[model samples]
Target: MSGIRDAAAILAERLHAFRSLGDNCEFGFVQRYGGVEPSGLLRFSYTPLEDLIRGLRCGFSDFGVPGDLRLSVSAGGTYYCHSVAYNIWANTGHSAGSIAPEALLEREYGRLAHLKGKFLEDLADGTKILVRKTGRDDPESDFARLAEAVWAHGPSTLLRVTEAGPGWVPEPARRVADRLIAGTVRRFAPAEQAWEVDLEPWMHLVDGAYALARGAAPARLDADAFPEVLPLPGRLRRHVGRHREPALSAYTRAVDPAAVRGDAVHVFSSWVWIPEDFAGTRIFAAAGYARLGWRDADLSRRGCWQRVWAAGRLRPEAAREPVGLGMIGTRRDAFWSVGARFAEGPIPGEGPAPALRMPPARFPGRDLLGRLVPRFA
Candidate 1:
């Protein structure tokens, strides 16, 4: 019986490793095992898509939750690309709120038009519908097109639009753009919010839209007033000094491997709470980082692992791999790292820290909101 228990432990470690490798490659960074800091809430503008993807991946990988992974990427000159892990788990369940490609596009376009009209009306007078197109051509047209694509296409298109020169948008238009870029709004009701529509889905849509229109995403909206917040940070910090053993133990008890299908398991941490139905019997794990202004009680910390594993286990093939382990949270303000112990080897001693890479370059003329910097010429 002791030998059997040992074997189970070995199997869990191996499975976690396998899943971790796959996740790291896809997003260019590991999910869990990082730290965070308090850099003003407005810092979301300075964050790059690559950094956000890496941070989110690390967070989910650590917690060991389960589900599909989705991200919005930028493409063409004025388009943003949206991607998702395509599989049964992501598609078949009641899991979260999802907008069809057409619906997402229409909703975003309507919002843009509404906001634009408001800004214009507040500034000058006559502002009417001009034209709206969706595609990747006619770079100089007065009315540019924006196309929304999905990552299921293996680099699918998301938002494709043409660039309109200054002549098309006069001085009044400039002020309107400034106001639209700075504006923000929120919804609170029912005393309780659903994770699908109220949180994750809204985050993805709003962030993607901001990326396309403003060149930056919105920082997380505060929900402190809500009850039962996920991933209490204080609980997470306590688990850390003990090398995550206590947290792992609690999670193991919460999960039942017998209920989980497939020979392998994966884990991740995230900022959103995952429903128990998604875990089944899989051995899930969680980790926390301190960067990105995530406190010990931040839901993103707990939600990280849930998000990554959920994405990986969407297919039986992915679930059959060497098993997986991940962590999420904020990286220390300056550096990033990942640590693991294989089933057959001794854990290595601590070493020099890894350097965080510089964020991607912003286009010279583009503002944080993705608008072109005004050029008199």
Candidate 2:
């Protein structure tokens, strides 16, 4: 446990030296394990943190992880992750295409277009100040006054009530909304009254819109917020793609050895910069794996005209040995490589990585919202 903590501290220091801590870059450092399943095929696991570190250090005596292993560190530039989550939630499903009055006001005032960067900066710094209103009177007028106050404050974002009328938002819906607002907005005070806004146990339709153009809305807008679209700090879309696409393929088994429970795979970690839509420095660190089996052993069967589908297919007879291609180590070293060498002989000592993939990176962005609504689609 101390070793892992020390490792984390070292990683933090390195990132700090690299200036990767701020500048809106998401950072992650994790270790992945590969297990030589009972079938002699390799399977990689996502177990993250202490358990993963423990397994790796112990030669995985508990489960028998063998073959090859590597430690991973990564960082990526991103839009404010809270905004990204709100945007994704707003643009998908029922919330899609639904415009907010606050959004209209923002364009009219040009707050987001001109002040987005500053707003994000404040939000990230936890220096954002929200002036709440009782909303006992007209919500429209209250929203207008709130907007003016925010404008006077200069370069801050807005949080408004999504629904109008007398009834409070339903408890579950209110919980979601409060979670989004309180999570996004860091601090707040009363606009017209002396009382402080209820944030910790927040249950209001009002919420912040730091990334309004990126689909800003309070949680009450849609209670069924996609689990994938929750606030996560410095979480760029590219990292998510790596997890869903390539990393996922490693575990799902693009090709599987028949009758074997779990085996026939090779894994490694890679470091590369993920491209950003806007011009800015970015970082990407990841561990990826590939299956080591004949194309004929592909788990998914191709129907008639398989040859047409799989053009340039290698004959199973010609491709006699199973070879899974993978690369491991830091950007500098190919500490390990699989493909030709793995087919020839067994690599010693590293054992297998582990039985689980690293868990998703945790940061302050999701906080309460992640707990309130655990199910994400």
Candidate 3:
């Protein structure tokens, strides 16, 4: 079986979640076999399992994916716990998925034999350093690497384009997801949410040239095989070409075509990079594009801090400082929140995952940006 299907079969059965009063099957904790204890309850959906699988395999950020995602611990055969996406983020909402430390180590049902985990939480917790950031760099931050990966792969979670819809109609779902997530920032983000990029991919480059670096191949994405740029309507292409530089014009060719249409309204929404390395400091962050961080004009400007955030949590241990935009999220946050080895967002009860967004793209600067922003961008 594919790595994802193997994980789904295991955790989907063990998770504990809460089901709202909707017209669907009930979902929560489930009892196990062979006298095994019950896996704790969680709130998640098993539908669109494909999206969840892509999220686990590629480390697709919640924002980049069209639908939202929930990671729940799934284990099979007594050893190894896999963090799998339990729900697809769509118009309805997402599930509350988390596991306790004690439950993950159970002898018969939860012992992780020789399995090496690779979920977002694992990377955040620093297990899969190579996969998380790949020690790569871009002008702004490693997140650029991740963004490139997400856009290139076009995982089902974030690729919602329909065959016949207007070039960009499929984009509304993403904007809606962002609005739902913004309200839950402080509650979920790490008390110490921060990362340093003084000299990355380069530092690694220098290190690679030194010891232990000989024979080691550099980590990178294939520049030539990026997914085909989504087709843009003729008018939209001209509109983008008129305002953006050649580089941006080339870049927008790859962005969700609908988001860039001149007539379409959009908000560059929620972004989190969980697997980033902060070295030794804690920071709290929320994705934003208001007056505080990068203005919409900078969207075309690469390598600059775009998704900035107001820093620090209410907790004193969590340092207070401005959070520059980059891929943000990690196991450290989950370590404090759920005591689990890894997790995507904060544990369900700790805080809601707010659908954050970059400020709406400002063309001429209109008052109705608040309403029109989510639709295009």
lDDT of 3: 0.22
- As a whole number from 0 to 100, the lDDT of residue 35 in candidate 1 is 10
**C-alpha TM-score for every candidate:** 0.19, 0.17, 0.18
- Give per-residue CA lDDT, model 3, range 1-377, as digits (tens): 23222221222121211111111112111111101122211112222333433553455443222222222433321122222333432111212233343443242122211111223333334211121111112233333333343334332111111122112111111221310100001111111221111111112222222112123332221211111112223121101122221221111111222222222111121222221222212223221121111112222332112221221112222223121222212322210111111111111011223232223233422345543222222
Candidates, ranked, TM-score: 1, 3, 2
Q: Which runs of model 2 end up more than 4 angstroms from their true locations? A: 1-131, 138-146, 152-155, 161-167, 170-213, 216-377
lDDT (10s digit) by residue, model 2, range 116-146: 3443344344333232322234445534443
Q: Give the better candidate number (2 or 3) by lDDT.
A: 2
- Candidate 1 lDDT, 165-274, residue by residue in tens: 22222111111232121111122112111111111221222233334344443332222111111222222111111122222223212222233432322222322232
Flag the better candidate by lDDT, 1 or 2.
1
lDDT accuracy of residue 166 in candidate 3? 18
Q: Sorted on lDDT, highest at the top, how do the candidates line up?
A: 1, 2, 3
Q: Poorest 10 consecutive residues of model 2 by lDDT?
A: 303-312
Q: What is the lDDT of residue 312 in candidate 2?
A: 13
Q: Please give the CA lDDT of all the candidate structures.
A: 0.23, 0.22, 0.22
